[model samples]
Target: MISRMLVKMIAVLWVGIAAGWLNPAVSYSEEASEKVLKLHSGLYYTIQKGDTLWDLSERFFDSPWVWPDLWQKNSQITNPHRLYPGEQIRLFSREETQTMVVESRPEPEVAVEPQEPPYYFYPPINSVGFIKERPVRPSGAIFKVKGNKAMISYGDLVYIRPIGRPTFTPGDRFTIYRVLEPLKDGEIKADVGIQHCILGLVEITEGHPKFAMGRIVQSRQTIELNDLLMPYEARSPKITLTQSKKRLEGKIIASEGHERIFGDQAVVFIDKGRQDGVRVGQSYYIYEQEKERLDSKKKEDLLLSPVDYGDILILHTEETTATALITRAEKTVRPGARIRSPF
Candidate 1:
């Protein structure tokens, strides 16, 4: 029997991290490689509702990056991208399984929308989360505001240093984030990262990379001086819940506002991140671990299985932390609760 259930990682994470996988020792001529169809076989998993081949790859091989690779190996599957419940999936082994001729599928056309660092909207903005890890120092900051204004908001003149000729162009846009305090895992102060809070966004109005000025195109919160400015790229991802290919245990480290107790539509933070095989858009059930109160005498305390507090949609991820928005909650969830893959 399989020891436990599994969770999933992202399918679109293949550009880097090749060093961690095995390299083929045998080399074949171009003609020989083209003629043969590569096939791999290993233990099989019975698919359940909402199971995807990418999820299977993550479970058997700890990689969601190779669903297409797995697709080429199976004679039974026409499209690895599509899957159904109660089907047996053969997961190929690396040492013995190799393939030629990968069946291709029509690449789905995706619409690119203007993205925030990573924000979401499904039933409105209920929660906003953050991560505490080694933060990347921004390339620029809001050094001074024009007109000596106390604060700046959407559409304001601002002067930046260094001038744009060397480092930035006049049309380039940047994500605005205010660096918050460092959050610790427990009590340790040495292990810390600046809590980067997404403030809004800015478009370079004039100048160069060394010194540039821009207008606040949008603002979710108050824009202030010294706010960190990072080169912006559209990262807002469409999120949905799916089965996890692995059983990952993570903790709720903080609430959106660091509140002790929070209810429906609140944003929260978790300890899991990209380095831990967590991907943005994957959902996990938030749970609370508790010990059952004794009744008639077993002499020792018994801990109950974790109770489901709610579910959360991961919005963004860092190396060691992730920002998630709460979809549902009961009992006013708090930090220190555990989160595991949705079975």
Candidate 2:
């Protein structure tokens, strides 16, 4: 009787193991269901498996780059990087009292205070293009690319050669860029400056007397062979809004991506810069020139008053030009659009 019972138990255990192995989908479902407990609902999110600040920000706020705003909005979360399952994340706050009910029990009333708005604007400093008044004096050039590819991006390795002197060292960083063309003012029909489009960033991993090897750390666009390298200067994206004291006006000379028409959140270039008292973080109004046709011998023309249609915020400034981002617009903003300070 004891031997018969032992044999029966062994048969049951073997059957269970075989079932689990044969039905792989069932095993996968059980593993997947263990990760998540609940989903987000009504101004609150119950943290689940694979939930991150970036993902939550992108899901709720419509942008992954605005994760800092999400972190600033929540006061209960201690660490921005680490989130545990079953934890609570406040999506946003309201001025009124918040009531939470759980498991048929009512929790205490929590009053949420209104927070002040942010004054500084964060722009993508490295990805935007700028107008250079003079020719670019490159530090080096990317001669060869690794991994049998012509175009490279983030984390790709490339060999660089110095232009005049070899001053590259391990851990040295450089900005990769390429000259697009000479930006010319459409109104004046003259060349304003050279336009340089930022490609990516690289850091030296191995340095030699004549040549150095580096890996691409950050890429805004595709990095190609013979891309010019410049000394990288780390700049903060945060720029405080400042009231302009001078009444300045300029015309949009060009825009990023060379698009003929661009609107909100698009990066553009203006003819005004530091020489014209243009500073970063200053806001400008975009205006459209109004014209009227006169019926003369050959149908003469008359210029009317300009009308404001949009707003632009300055991001970076050169000697004679400035890079700006369109903040608000109700009409089409394009090249030759006028820009004036708000005073």
Find the candidate with the highest lDDT and give its number. 2
Superposed by TM-score, candidate 2 places the C-alpha of residue 253 at a distance from the truth, in angstroms, of 0.6
- Candidate 1, position 199, lDDT: 75
Q: What's the lDDT for residue 78 in model 2?
A: 43
TM-score to native of every candidate shown: 0.59, 0.66
Off by over 4 Å in 2: 1-52, 55-66, 69-118, 292-305
Say which candidate scores most in TM-score. Answer: 2
Worst 10 residues of 2 by lDDT: 93-102
lDDT of 2 by residue, 113-181 (tens): 686444554535656778988868999999998887967875578999899875888878888999977
Per-residue CA lDDT of candidate 1, range 110-226, in tens? 798665444343421211336656676676778898888998875677776542333666667777777667876553334435577777767777875357888765466788888
How many backbone collisions does model 1 have? 22
